[model samples]
Target: MDKPVLPLTYEQIDHWIASLQPELAREGFTHAVGILRGGAWPATLVSHATGAVPAFLRYERATRTAVWDSSVPLPARGSKVLVCEDIAGAGHTLADCVSFLREQGLVVKTLTVVFDDLSRMRPDYGMDCRGYFALLPWERHAYTDRYRARWQHTQAGTLGPIGEDHEFAVYAIDLDGVLLPDVPPHRYDADLMAALEERDALLPFEHLPQIDFSRTQAIVTGRPEIDRARTADWLARHGYAHLRLVMRDPSRHGEHPEQVAAYKAEAALELACTHFIESDPVQAIFIAQHAPLLRVVWWDAARRAAKLIATQAWRGADAPTP
Candidate 1:
């Protein structure tokens, strides 16, 4: 069999991830292992998806044709491991990793990649995102430009989808208000992230139960690890109880802020996401160059709850933008 040509920028990876979360959570695993660097980020994402904390596996193959060669290997204990890589091309490295683990007497429950390239081989778990190979050229563009005053929404599996170029289920959401809260809300700067924690504090387990955290394969953001860590931690602490993942923003994903929403949206749409949430009312044109993401304006939980209290989902779509 021949290996498919998928790029590292494919968007379907998110879709694959979103679709895979529920399965991962339903069949809970013990520990998650990351491939390092690229794999680390995906591990964080998977962690967020599965709500499981992951450990790093220090291994460097140096070449695709060679066997596993690294100073660090999996632990000696027999753990239900979910090994991850940033993007996969066939199952060469993963196969080697599995073999190595087996040799040491370990159990690997699942082998997944943020991006899976099935041109030739396949991993036990992951989305089949193939568009990455075709859009490699533009896949690079996802980070090149900004909003540019035009509304662009990615479907979550195409911009620069990485992996074997397969299809998987996905959840699409307009970030900003949904994940990061579009604006700070007040002069004090909403500390949007702080608000996230605040909101989580109010809820029994944050607001995780309110939304489908298990289906969240990815949460696109322009924020750096430092800014995202606080809120991400909160999610991990309460929302994502235990699902292995690496939830750090990649330099590439965060490069273009203006276009970030659209790029992410585009990928989300492709995966036929379950839902989307966003708000640009608080931002200037410079911030939300492309406004009016969806039909219903975004509102805070208080307002949203108020609307439901007074009426029903029949009036849910037209909620206020405050």
Candidate 2:
């Protein structure tokens, strides 16, 4: 059994911060000390909201050392300070930082965006996000295998493998019809080189799907890997350079719809994506059939609507006409 992930958006964070403002403003905090990196976002926002002098402390997880950032002047002894962190999990960072601040004779009240039941130190203020693996938008790259390997190297002895322990909202999308117009097959049949040139020239659709590209983990395309250069160029030109592009193998080029769907299903599984958005209804259905647990959405470009495929049963006859 895996812990379900709660994908958090910036809007949700903003809302959480907003909800904290009135209470934080009432606290009359003199200084805001943000834990470096993740904590900085909330701490800076809290400072702006409460008029607290901002400071930071960088904590080295491996060394269990907390060092105040010398660039920002430390809060005066006896001054009331509000310490902020992104999360207070089963980690010592928050506890240690609070202790360090208290030892300096500063009055400290802890704050965090989220804290679980197993947290080492419960903050005075934070949302109770127990049970779920709270995935933040800023740390989206943590879903990668490399990051997991790093985590295993550093903390796996205590925390276990992140993938097996937690479910994540990794998303995959189709490239051609979803991001841009699909180059008509007839165009390619007529003139392969000219069609490739036309595809390379085609701009992203004027009205694209309502997907948050920030959360889109990969672009799975039926286009052969031979078009990698042009596909990459188009993606980069359209401000999606950061996304991973998975193309059909050159050996499997010109595969039929069933083969293409198989390739997509395999890619989705390989990537461990939880959801997939596809442009073709048939492909979407096939993907859902192959990966029953995955949430597949069919994007109807012409209708400007997205339909969720709830059942794995094939309903090609019911599929909307292109």
Candidate 3:
């Protein structure tokens, strides 16, 4: 199945920039350098965030060489320079720049907007690419014509829009119970991992037919972030790795395990999820309050189709339960 082309907005980019500020500071980078085209904006944002001098570095990918063509010279030797780029796939170009910068005697660290899961080079900081493809905000224009036509076709003959107030909405699905067999939390073990690894060991819920995983924009789960890699691997093996996988940050809510709904709700709101297919009934209720713009649907175990919990229904309480 073809992967969905997710479009990003400037708001999301600002979130990335704000989130990366402190991490960049800890690395002690004195300068920020961007690779041509895609890298320029992110590098500038990081520089502004970190109070580092912003500069540009060009890479000749065909020759795998880093070129220093700016009229101004690079930072002095021993200066910490953070190399920035939009995305790193195979990372050959990034690796070449790192090598060249080091050869020039500059301290080099790296940052990228996103990185492929199986990428050869891992940046010091990066967001993992959930899907096989990404359409960055800067690159959105190039794909607009194609994406618009495809989106229109996909929405045709369906409801007016997909999201709460939009002309179309994106789906958000849960993994446990909905996609895979549900093992009690206490019973989730290595055996489950082995089964997931085998691909056929797991089965989709009986009621919900085999779904086109590509349709889901986000997998909002209550699992902790520490399991991200393991969860991603399982999803990838099952051909569902392209969608964004959201896990709870244990450190932030160490005392509130019951607030899983809050975590899922916040993620759904941030990711602009319009329709949600969840397994947990309590979470479905909480999600309705937090994600007012989202239409919540519970995957009823005994039902033929998903159960719509609420749509634009205002409920009391927006605060996360303590």
Q: Which candidate number would show the highest lDDT if scored against the true structure?
A: 2
* Local distance difference test, each candidate: 0.46, 0.81, 0.70
* Candidate 1 wrong stretches, greater than 4 Å: 1-19, 63-76, 111-120, 131-316, 319-322
Model 1 Cα lDDT, one tens digit per residue, 209-288 = 14454555455444445665564665576554343323325564454544554454444333333233334332222222
Count of clashes, each model: 68, 0, 6
> Model 3, range 112-143, lDDT digits (tens) per residue?
88777557798888877766556575553333
lDDT of 2 by residue, 119-183 (tens): 88889988888987666756654645556665767575665444532244668999888888888
lDDT of 1 at 224: 48
Q: Per-residue error at 194 for model 1, in Å? A: 53
Could you tell me the TM-score of candidate 2?
A: 0.56
